[model samples]
Target: MRPTDIESLIGVGRPAISSDGAFAVFASSRPDLAADRTVGQLWRVDLAAGTPRRLTRGVHDRSPRLSPDDAVVAFLREDARGRAQIFVVDAGGGEPVQVTDQPGGVTDLAFSPEGGRLAFSARVPEPGRYGTVEGRDAAAEPPRRITGIRWHANGLGYLDRPAQLFVVDVPATDAEPFYPPAPALDEPRARVVAGPATQLTHGDADWSGVAWTADGAELLSVPDEIESRRRDLRDRVVAIAVDGGAQREVLGTTENLSIASVDVAPDGTVFALANDVGEGGVDFVAPGVALFAVEADGPRALTDAETIDLGEVGSHLTFDGDQVLVQDRARGRVRLLRVTRTGAVSEVLGGDLEVNGHAAAAGRVVASVASPESFGELVMVHGREMRALTSFGATARERGVVVPVEREVTGRDGYPVHGWVAVPEGEGPFPVVLQIHGGPYAAYGVHLFDETQVLVDAGYAVLYANPRGSAGYGRAHGRSIRGRMGTLDFADVMDFFDAVVADDPRLDGDRAGVMGGSYGGYLTAWIIAHDHRFAGAIVERGFLDPAAFPGSSDIGSFFGQEYVGTDPARIAAQSPMAVVDRVRTPTLVLHSERDLRCPLDQATRYYAALKSGGVEAEMLIFPGEDHELTRAGRPQHRVQRFDAVLEWWSRHLPVG
Candidate 1:
């Protein structure tokens, strides 16, 4: 998918499921609207009727969640000030009641098992650097500084202040800030589940992908961090009980397991997907992906290792205490299957139902399914029957969209570099865009709702190749570029392009564009800085100065010591900024003003250098957005980003 067209189906964060499993809620763009202009709205569906319904009419609403009792839906909406606040709306559709009008925004949210209480994660605004009242509310004064985990931090990327879950009693009458006063330490009140939501773990532990047990007493989650030096995606599954104090890790990183989805069986057995540690570190474990279970004895591999490679990225593993529901996307299409405790896998539904996000409630599973519709439908599945609960599917499927061609390109080092190439619909020569994926750790795969389809539709051939250091290729392939920065990855992109252009004439070798975000951004900038063959380049949220990034970026450890080597001297040599003056190609610098991953400084420095060096360069900055702006920011900003990037290519590599 081109970046612009994928914007409409861009789904991130977590999906919400109704208590009764009748409807699912998700955020998606209106297909009828232009790329640079529409807002994401909450839509619902009648599982049996397969009819989608719009829940919110606002221009920008996101992270829609259903209350425990299913009467109210809580979500975050951007205000005029650009701060996101929590709001509650009746499921039956009406004016939403504002919950938090404060400046500091709310990030993560959840509803207590009982409708009596609402549990959510929020960041209370802190005063400016200089303020008279040290701990004052500052509500009476204009917000001097927007303080919180989601907001952008100056030197230190996005400081994801751990989302401490808070509980506020559902007021008998309408009330603002729906958040109740801090929970009393000594007394156990009915307000919000107290200590359980607080620091359940120690030492800046990141808690995400939270799934509640059927009884809500135990919670299963994946706490993960990428070990850069070792180049490992490490994660542990911990079980936390409401009455228990500290969480216990049942699954460790011994097997190179990065738990993506976990569903606890009625018997307390946790089912997850894991891989075996092979040669190239985590990369060598290609066949390690499989469905597994953990119980009193230990973890056991459930799925047959020979039958499938076990897809993990787009596929989610869920168990109903007995049967497991997995949305497998490894085979190019989304397939739903039921796995019994005996390890017998039966296909439930398999077609073009591209499931992006999913959740299981009681006896049914709710998922975000996209097809030809502009918006994704909240699909519900029960036993042998499947139906769409929401009618928000796209009005008409856009045809002639290019399907990516998946294959392998030989790396300069002789190893086959695996990647996907999307060609535009044309007979003659067409300009090409070398699209790089983020997550020097993440691999480019066949996942749905990707935003890179725009370039191909506009008559530009797109190539997304996973060079050395990308996950899913095996450890050695991923670690091949360690301590080498732009060496191996740079060669891979250039060589892959050579092969593609040699094989296809539609690809105009003379005019080419390079684009990527985060690590991809770094690669894009590095490409233009070191090589001038590209006609134009687009770098989004990528690092320029490796030295400055060590202490400033969120995952400093990712590139600082891991990929670029720990020594400051070595980092400087590998930095794109150190050699930016060499760049002569026209470049478009794009980043969220508040992006934490690469930070705005990375963009500004490169932009200034390009302009000062007499190079054609432009910077697109979205205000008050973090690293996820492209997928989760205000709808307008997302649209503008696509239009701007496309416009840059139009001006430089104009295709008639």
Candidate 2:
């Protein structure tokens, strides 16, 4: 696919299945070339008939959720002022009604068990004279007092506001709609119809993944209690009563594991995806599905030591009767697996395609699936049968797409590395670009990646692999590079590249380039510093100095302690900046101005050092963007990023 094809690509998000498994609703985005932006809308699909239909047409809508009774679907949409407010529409089809009016936008939301209330998490401004100001005023007026270590996030920007849970009562009838009919066709039609929302949780800690109990009397959530200054604080599961009583911890105090997501079963069994702390460190712990009983001794891991790794990016867990339905990553594909209370794991639906998000009900699963040729579409799973619900990427597939061929390379340490190689249509000894994935813990699976496809379209062979530190292989494979970031993991990357080059004579080793973001960015920087086989390198939001990173990044204070250790000397040694003087490859650095994860300073420091050493280097900073620039950035910006990569590679690794 061409780089411009990004605008036409339809992207799908999380899906919500009705309680009776009759229908499902999900959020999807398609390019609006007229507006020079992508517009998000909610879509519904019938499970029995397998027909997809658009439900709501909004500028930006997401987080579609079905109420318990499946009468209405609640979703978040941006108002004219850009604040994300919760809106509800009939499950069958109708105009959406606004439910909340929070100054700050609502994020993760959930419906009450009885479908009478909606609980949502939103960022509320700090108590001050200028606190209530929102939209353009809040952006223009910014002279804030920084008080805490975790004050800024990569995409969301300054954490000056606190995220809290709010609940609003839904109306029993729609005789008088929350909003009146629009006078003009283009005017917004959402009006606040629900009662004034009551604040549920308070304080500086951020609460998310709100889930209601089976009885509809209480809510369970994972709250990051920032009691200490250390960035390595672990979040705990807490129960908040519907009556607004004091919240109580469902799990006992133990900082060993960092809880990611939480869900409560009908029998009061709490299930979570968590990373168990080991001697290696906390940040590198491979997340696994676990079950927690309020009366049992403690949480018991359900998928521990298994080959399947929980999809931590956007995966969720829910109870299907006594079985816990989980979406996880195996090899390069995200699949749905059923885990019983006795630790028995079995595949329900998934193979070849990547399941982005899913919701289960009445022994049926509705998920958004994507592949190497398709972007993302909705699918339904019942028993052993799976059927397509949407065909959004039919045009792209018809235009001829480059499908990656999977290859397994033996690492220097005797471990097998999984990767994909995608070649252009017509080529001979073509320039190759080695693409690395971020999260250091995440894997590049059998999914359609825009970045990889763009490179292939530009007449470049793209090679992406899951090295030693990547998940989906096993727990040991993921934790192999915990303390030794640049040692074994780096070796695995080089080994995989060497094996691919030796086997494929069409790939030009002399005209090779490397690029990656986040953890992948870190590896690209590290690879160039240690070895100069690559002619060009692109580092996007990478960490160079571990010592400085722990202080400047959002997860800085604790990430270093977990990955590199407490020793200052060892941390410095593992950083790419330590060996900058030995680097000779031309490099391009890209970073977002508002990126708090790796921060802008990390890029600036590396660029300055490269220039000082008389090395060819260029730095580009995206304004008002964050670490998720490539994945969820503005449409135009994403095109520009791909263009920049192609331009850089052409200039440095030109193929004549």
Tens-digit lDDT track of model 1 for 1-656: 44445444634324677666666666655532354444667776655555556788877788877876778888888776666767778876776766654344566555555555444444432334113355644356554343322333343333333333334444432443235556677755433212222434433345554555556665566664423244455567876654444576777766566565666555556787766544333333233467887766767777764444455455666545468777554333455667787778887666655566667777887666655333365566677677765544232234334457776778677977777777766686888889888867566655443454667667788888888767655445556677887988889888898898888888888888889988899999888888888889998998778877754566553446666777877887788898888999888889887776776787888889889999988888888888887656656676677889889999988987
Collision count for each candidate, in order: 32, 3
List candidate 1 stretches off by more than 4 Å. 1-41, 55-118, 124-162, 168-317, 326-354, 360-365, 370-375, 379-425, 443-453, 471-480, 485-488, 529-531, 567-574, 578-584, 607-625
Instruction: State which candidate has the highest lDDT.
Output: 2
- Give per-model TM-scores: 0.71, 0.93
* Residue lDDT tens for model 2, 1-656: 77778765787898998888888899998665456566889988888896788898898788898888889899999876678899888888887888888777888788887788998888887754234643345556747766556666666766666678878887544546643666886987555556788888888778877888778777888776543444543557788887864688887447456676887787767777776554333444455434433445777777764466775577777678888877777788888888887878888877788888888888898878888777888888888888888888787776558889999999887878788899887747889899989988888977777888888878888888998878888777877787889888888878888899889988988889999899888889899988988998999999777878766888886777777777878887788888888889999999988888888998999999999999999999988788888877777777788888888988998866
What C-alpha root-mean-square deviation, in Å, does candidate 1 show against the real structure? Answer: 7.3
lDDT of 2: 0.80
